[model samples]
Target: MSRLIYMGFKLLEPYEGKLSRTVLRGESGSNPADLPDKAIASPLMANYILYLYKTMRKFWGEPIVVTQELGDILGNAVIKDSILASSDTICLLDQSKFRGNYEQVAKLLALNEVEQRKIFTINGLDNKAGRGKFKEVYIKRGNIGEVYGVEVSLFQYLTFTTEKPEKTAVESYVARFGSYSAGLEAFVSDLRSSRLGLADFIMQVNAE
Candidate 1:
């Protein structure tokens, strides 16, 4: 058997390029002093999830978990305890799709009648006019829970969307400027100048 070991600085480099030292070295100013607070968050880093969750809490940092399906947590032993138990705040989007099997979810999250009502009320409110399309979310911290409407601008929508075509178009522009933030700024400027809606702009890009 042969071995390829990357020790020392080689371990700090990203797969293709140099890792950003700002977040890794606490140079971002928002991070803790002289501590690698970011630690390059990745799905593959679940090996140390429990440790990360415990230590981060001790340092006044939060560890968040996001999943499309509740089964991802309820079905797993490690996550069912480590992540779910340690999470103090819970955020939920529209969960009407899980109405049939929601009792388990309710029990798991320890939701009371008020909290359960709040969860079902997500995206069920009468929003004001000219506010653009948006969805509501339920956020529960401690014992109380509240539903808040989430409405973002066009640029923010593109930035946050998970659709393949939209992401592809966004990345195409990102590649041009060699910086995601700068590229996204340029994309928004050009999109506005084109005077087309987001759907129309996406269709035009996909066609070309």
Candidate 2:
């Protein structure tokens, strides 16, 4: 039996549903702020969730937890009266096995530099027992990219910068003419628009 306490914006109606269901997956629980370390946890890094919740409260009403009937799960947690939502993030608390797997998945996702930089940053990294976690955003991608079978020499020679906040390094790639997008439609458009081969495309981007 594992438990998770997550924070998400109430302003986004779609996300409220998604976040609530996600947190209730097992013998889980939630807290408005941070929960104790006995359980694994990850939080969002930005306050964007707070801004959305406050701005959209009138139309969507206050964000809330949906009732899911389960034994000893969904423990009592307070709904804070304050406007500043803590972390505006998602936290997962679960059994050791699930926690390990979850952290690995988070790491894998974070490896996708564009998505990682856009959504979350690697605040803390550890492989220790009973205390591994990563913070991320609640924002869902409005678009997804597809591989284009194109490659170019100049595109292959661009070197990626190794600088502070490496996650945003993809932005530099974009500045050098790399096209990355979340919208599938836009992605398809860009892919079709390109004339480079797949290997050459990666090489060009990597060189940048």
Q: Which candidate has the top score in lDDT?
A: 1
lDDT tens string, model 1, 85-150? 778888899998887778888888889877898888787767656565478888888888899888
Superposing every Cα of model 2 onto the true structure, what RMSD results?
Answer: 17.1
lDDT of 1 at 188: 82
* Weakest 10 consecutive residues of candidate 1 by summed lDDT: 1-10
Candidate 2 error regions (>4 Å)? 1-60, 65-170, 177-190, 194-204
What is the alpha-carbon lDDT for the whole of candidate 2? 0.33
Which runs in model 1 stand beyond 4 Å of their true positions? 1-47, 158-208
Clashing pairs in 1: none
